[model samples]
Target: MQGFHVLVAGVEPTARQSVPQAFRVSEVVALDAAGLHLLREGDGEPRATGLAPLPCLALFATPKTLPLMREARAWIAAQAAAPVPDVVLLDRKSPPAFVERTLLENLAAANAALAGSALRQARRVARLRAEVEMLGAVRAGLDRFVGETGLAQLKRVFSTATPDFETQIELVHGAPLRQVLPVAGTGFAAIDLACTGGKRRGSFVARLTLLEDGEVLAEWRVPTPAQDGWVRLGLPVAHAGLLRTLCLVVEPASEKSPCANLALGAHQPLPAAQLGDARTGLPIAPHSLAFRLYAAVPGTTPPHSADTLMPVAARKAKPVPYALQALPAEDLARVAETDPGTGGPNLLFVADVAAILCRPGAGGRIRAACPAGARGLMASVGVHADTPSAAVGVLGVDAGAAEPALQRVPVSSGGVEEVSLLFPEPLREARDILLSAEAVDGAAEGAWVVFRDLRIYT
Candidate 1:
């Protein structure tokens, strides 16, 4: 009567496994409990044959009726001496208006009481432990208190719990930790040359702060060898939170000495940024380089080609031509626009059109290499039209395979949506693959699809 139990009925499909077969609406006309056995009678009073074990029940309006809901609540009230149910599963989909309101109100009240009891119990245990430690002995008063409040039962139940209460419930409500990504490091070339003859390596500190409140989330330091000319300080910023705005404080090896000319990169496209400050002008303002945040999930296996990634400034210096034919260059480019610079500049997609066919004369295919061990590709895509039935997918091809693996993406006529495509098991070990899009429903050519920030992560 002091522990947690859930009430479930047959009508709730998801709670079916938790409910006993005897208590299902179809199996029982009346449900009564005798010790651990739930007496389920079919259209009659409980009989000896109807006795069955039921450890839990989850009550819900399964048949969409008000009477059943009331009956379930009444049964729970009648079992007040028994343990109060801790979890209530309510059907949110299409319930009687009054039943929905009543269920939510009662469920809220019960859960609030449960939470309060748990908190008080925790405080009581802590106080008893403190008293035991101070007195250096277990007191009779403590024993009596524990017996009266069922503290022993709580302890026994919690001893075997995996995560414990605080981690599972309390800490989950706390602020989330956002991951910080390493974008670029100030190589500090000339500063390294000047500090080389002194003593130690020259270092630079980069700070990330909130623009609104100026709260420092994290700071990173990159060290460069003083004698190295083309020093590339690959400093990784390992912090978490919603990050924005960066500040760099240059440090020389010696005190009271001016730092030499500092450079930011030894790599191209070294974390795009703007140098000027928008706020009040200051000395730090002259030195501060503001950059946008780029967050990427860490992956163990690198993609075969990250050559075509997001925020691409222009077509690759050596453009890999699409294995395309049939459609004229202008129409083909217009139909499936690959150059991101022409439109909204970060994503890759087929241009929006009133209608476009996917026949031999219209559709084209683009091939991209997928190295072995590649598992999946993730991308944000949107397909929209005046009507429905828009879709896209990535095709994976194996070296000796007769057929290529295809992952088709269906798109609604709404705004943009995120999509993911998983490669087949055989194709995961494949060396080459093709990514293509075509009209799924041949009759409808009005569909338009766009894909943005496509990445293949292992």
Candidate 2:
């Protein structure tokens, strides 16, 4: 979502200096990637090394400079890549309330199985089932929360950029602006929320491999070939912002994946943020609650309990909790509240503020309409490189950064109280992570949270 360029007509860069730098969540802006002064490669005589329209176009997280560029050395073929830029700013910061469920508590059941020695393996299987059920419950619950909670509206801001982050920061630091197509990360938070607190500038990147004779050519860290291969995109923290969640719209390449390595690296590093507080001088908030959730296995098949998936133990799910520890209270409340209706504080645009933007007597610089449930906003776009389907471009960038302002968010999420999941977005996804809670001192097993008038002003 960061380092974006606004295209006026998909073919030229605009002359306007004060353009929409970034956009709010789901706010579809346009791109103007035409007339971009393409940097030439070589000496005076217009060195024509028989360049073939780049043969392909792909995008990278980093411009393949410095440590990343160096690590990508050896022409060992495309492995993968973040650049140095304005840190992502975590606008809505919130801490997490780790909770557990029945299936997870059954973690103890694995103990008896383990003690039986002969039943150790048996217990392992049972534990795994418990864990599986734990996560399934969490996913279902989270889905429900998002649908029922009003906070889902806040999602419009999720994975979006502010006008400032774009022009003032990104325009000078990362890429150009356009009015055609735009892109962003998936959600917020990371696996290590408990420690560093997820916050980072988002970037669009992919892994690549060069081949000479089907033998891997000049492995350049670029985008999916406008030709072949299964490409994977990644986002790293160029700057700092409390990352709450990250979810790729992942409009897959026209074709499907080929089981194994069709192209990109393991999808593990895609658009993910850094762990621990390396930049910020603060420690991850000591969350009063923390939990882990995982994707459920198909066929209702279960997994081994404390036997192995112990990672959910933090030592295992350690990374996840650390990530959660970095969010804010409002966001945390949204996640912890049992009431799905509590997802968002009934969001309302400050009328006075809205009126100014929509002033019939003023310029059309800003629109007062909040585009939701539509095709999303699609304004001016600058596509340095565009794809017919998804956002994929092969970029060969220069060194140095544009130092854009940041609004970082974590790249991790945890499970609801009882349910479990492989939550990755730090705080943003809290409201969506599935969790199971204990019966309130003899209360019912169901739990929920609620929100009030969420009014936005100037």
- lDDT value, candidate 2, whole model: 0.21
> What residue pairs are clashing in model 1?
6-57, 7-57, 7-58, 7-59, 8-57, 8-58, 8-59, 178-240, 178-241, 392-409
Q: What does candidate 2's lDDT look like per residue over 1-458, in tens digits?
A: 23332211111122111232341111111112221122221333322222112111111112222233222221112321212111111111211111112212222443443367657778899999999999878855543343233222221122221112111111112221111011122231111101111122122221111111122111112222333312222112111222222221111122332111111111122222211121231222221101121222221111112212111112222111111111122232332222334434221212221211011111111121211111111111111112111111110111124321111111111211111122122222111211111111322212221111221100
Q: Which runs of model 1 end up more than 4 angstroms from their true locations?
A: 1-203, 208-217, 223-247, 252-281, 284-290, 295-373, 378-382, 386-404, 409-434, 440-446, 452-458
Cα lDDT of all candidates, in order? 0.35, 0.21
TM-score of each: 0.30, 0.19
Best by TM-score: 1
Q: What is the lDDT of residue 177 in candidate 2?
A: 16
Worst 10 residues of 2 by lDDT: 355-364
lDDT per residue as tens, model 1, 329-420? 12223434233343332223343422222321122233433445555554455655555656653433444546655566655556556555
- Using lDDT as the measure, which candidate wins? 1
C-alpha-based local distance difference test score of model 1: 0.35
- Scored against the true structure, residue 19 in model 2 reaches a CA lDDT of 31
* Per-candidate clashes, comma-separated: 10, 176
TM-score, cand. 2 vs. native: 0.19
